[model samples]
Structure formats: structure tokens, C-alpha cells
Target: MNNSNTAFELTIVVPVFNEEDNLERVKQEFDSYLSKSPYRSKVLFVNDGSSDNSQMFIESICKSSNKYSYLQLSNNMGLSAALKAGIDYANTEFVGYIDSDLQTTPFDFDLLMEYRHDYALVTGVRQNRKDSFVKNMSSKIANGFRRYMTKDTAEDTGCPLKIMKTDYAKKIPFFTGMHRFIPALIMLQDGKIKQVPVQHFPRIAGEAKYHLFNRMIGPFKDCFAYRWMKKRYINYEIINQG
Candidate 1:
């Protein structure tokens, strides 16, 4: 990794899994944001061991552009692993997470970033999700369960738009489904989290890797893991002046 002459304001991490069809659109949208947005940011594409043409597409994009770059895992490591890799490589002051499916626009980062100054983490909630009934209902059910279990109280845990300080992000313990547990994990470190409404659109291409079982059950199991971590979590603050 090349050290920047100065720290970047934000580094947006996009976890992709066989998203070949949507790759170019993601590129165009992010590229436009980098050029037109108020904040200076870099895009990191974590090609999460995609079996499709995603790896090659990412390689091409990185070769052609300096503003965008990518990292490929030896094999599939899921979203949590991809995000951990991105967070580990992050050299910016703040890091952001978004989906490559194009359902969540990167421009929404503009809104989330505005609140990052006030909170360690700023997340987005879909106002009117453009998804199927089954998809939407399943998400609601899972989110409701998550809220009841963890008491994070955010409207959308699955919304792809989030921005947070890199230092605070690094403190959260890594675990499966850690992506969805960001608010709770941040709270573990006494980090404040903010939520805001953002635009959500339907997926234009590529199949979702997660289904109801994987989305709901998988997170439910991980919620237990989170509770365990919370019980064992350690937090400390300085008591004396520097």
C-alpha cells in the first residue's frame, strides 16, 4: 500500500460477490462522486473471491484509474472478512462502507459524512425501500429481532451507507455478521452512532447472494456471538492530562 502524502478524508469500501453485471455501474457512480463530491475520498473494491468476471473487471478499473483501487482475497471470506480486509488496509481518517449492487447510491455518503464530525459512526436508513414484499418483510423481521436483542435502535442495519472514524472502526472486534452489528460494536467502544434517511433503489442486475435463511438466521446466530463479545468487551479512557 502506498502512503498518501496526506491522509484521505474517507475511504469507501465496497464488498463485491459475483457482481460482474453491476461492476461498471458501480465504477461510474463512484467515479462521479469522487470528481463531484465535496469530500476527497478513495474507493476500495474488496473483490470477495467472486467466481464471475468481477476480479478481472476490478483489475481493469484499478489499472485505468488511480482514484479507484481493489484488493482480491485468495478465496471467499464473506462480507465480514472483506470489510475487515478493507479496514485493515484503510489509511484515511474515516472509512465508509457501501454495496456494489448499486441499490445504495454513493452520493448518499455526502449526507452521512456531514454527521461523521459529530459521531464516530453515521449510518443510513432506506426511506421507502424498493424491494419485494418477501425481501422487505424479511429484513424488517430480522431488524426488529436485532433491535430487541441488542437495543441498537437504528432503523436499518442492512442499509449499505455508513461512515465512521477509522480508529474507532479498528477497535470493534471482528466476527461473522460483524457488518450488520456495526452500531452495537461501535457502542461497545463508547463510540457514538448516528442514523439518517437515504435513497434506496432496486437491484438492476446480479442475484443476491443472501436469502431469507442466510440473512435472518445467520445474523441471529451472530447476535449471540455479539452478546458474548459485549460481556467480555473491554473499554478504558485516560485519566490524566497528556
Candidate 2:
């Protein structure tokens, strides 16, 4: 349940799975970000049934400040599900996303916020990623295939630092791999997106959730699923409300 203060203009959603080692750092980074953010913003931690002590950490973090709240899923739903839940629960003009891993810093969110008014979504493209060779290669291949198939031209869909207008975000259909196609999904609704370069860091704690097979094969298959959905995707306008 959300234990928040006044309504915020932006709600930053951090999807947590089993990042027990990283929650304290997450709170610190967010505290710094929210304290200096130009727009009023708060954070929501979507704990996806963390078998570790992540839930306890989240609870303690939220209790310490009204700027934070969290939702705990019943089971270990994937990242896509966690993200969807956060978006749904957000009651703000803009919804932001960041991973708990801290590969991308929450401070870079300031860069994306610059274009928040003009674009439906502003996403970060990680600069000089600090992952292993295999992970980097698989991500490159997957990103190439996704762009080729979806033609979304999203430079780094997996960067995990994004801010999108809440209305556009809620319109996106949820799927197991919806996280990879956020730009494409927004484009399907005739929404514009801006991609900006953001700082990248090596993971200092916890384990990387993705590997070569899931990173490469999952997006490849999801690309087909996205293509199928795109062909039948619906868009409409209401010219009159009288």
C-alpha cells in the first residue's frame, strides 16, 4: 500500500525482485534525487515477490520517509509485470522507471525530465555499458533484431531509465516481454519519444538478472509477438464529448 504525502507530478517506479543487497543504496540514491528534483516526485518500489529480505528493506525504507511507498506482488512475476503494476498504481502526470541494480543512476533522470513536456516518453541510452562481453553482444543482437522488426529505432530499449507520460504508459498492453517494447508501444499510440545518452556503471552489488539466452532468445521471440500485436493494435480519437 502507498504511504505517500501530497500528490506528486512524477512517480518514479523501481521494480525490485531479489536485490536484497541493493535496497539501502537504492533508498540513498532516490533520497538524493527526490531532494533535488525540480518537479515534485516520489518513488514506488514494486517488490515482485522477493524471496530475499527485499520486502523488509522496502518496508523500512518507506516507513522512514513519506516520499516512498511499495507494492508487493504475490509471486515472482517478471519485470514486465512488475512495471505494469507500478504504472497502474501511479497517480501522477509522469511515470518514471529505473532498475534496482543501479547500472543506471537515478540522477540521470534529470536529463530525461528536460524533454518531458514535448515528448510522450524520454528514455536513456546507456553510454559505455559495463557488462561482460557475452552480455553486451547478446544485448546488441537483441536490440538490432527488435529495431529491425518493430522499426521503432529505439537505440537502447533495455537501458532501464525512462520517463513517460502517465496516460500513454497506461495505454500500453501488458505482456511477458512488454518491457523491451515500451518505445514501440508508445509509438503505436502515435506518441513521440526522445532518446538521450545517460551514464552507465558497473553493478556494485547483487546479481545480474539476465544472461545470454534470455537476453537474446526472449527478445527475438517477443519481437514476433510484438509484430503480431502491432498489426492488430488499436488507436482512436474522440472528436466530440458532448
The prediction achieving the highest lDDT against the true structure is 2
User: In model 1, where is the ten-residue run with the lowest total lDDT?
Assistant: 1-10
* Clashing residue pairs, backbone N/CA/C < 3 A, model 1: none
Error of 2 at 196 (Å): 0.7
The sequence of per-residue lDDT tens digits that candidate 2 reaches over residues 74-186 is 99999999999999999889999999999999889899999999999999999999999898999989999899999998999999999999999999998999899999999
Candidate 1 per-residue lDDT over residues 136-227, each given as its tens digit: 99999989988888889878988988998999988879877888889988888888889999999999999988887897789889888888
For each of the candidates, the C-alpha root-mean-square deviation to the true structure, in angstroms, is 1.5, 1.2
The TM-score that candidate 1 achieves is 0.96
Off by over 4 Å in 2: 3-6
Shift of residue 225 alpha carbon in model 2, Å: 0.4
Which lDDT values do the candidates have, in the order given? 0.88, 0.93
Off by over 4 Å in 1: 5-7, 238-242
Error of 2 at 167 (Å): 0.3
TM-score of each predicted structure versus truth = 0.96, 0.97
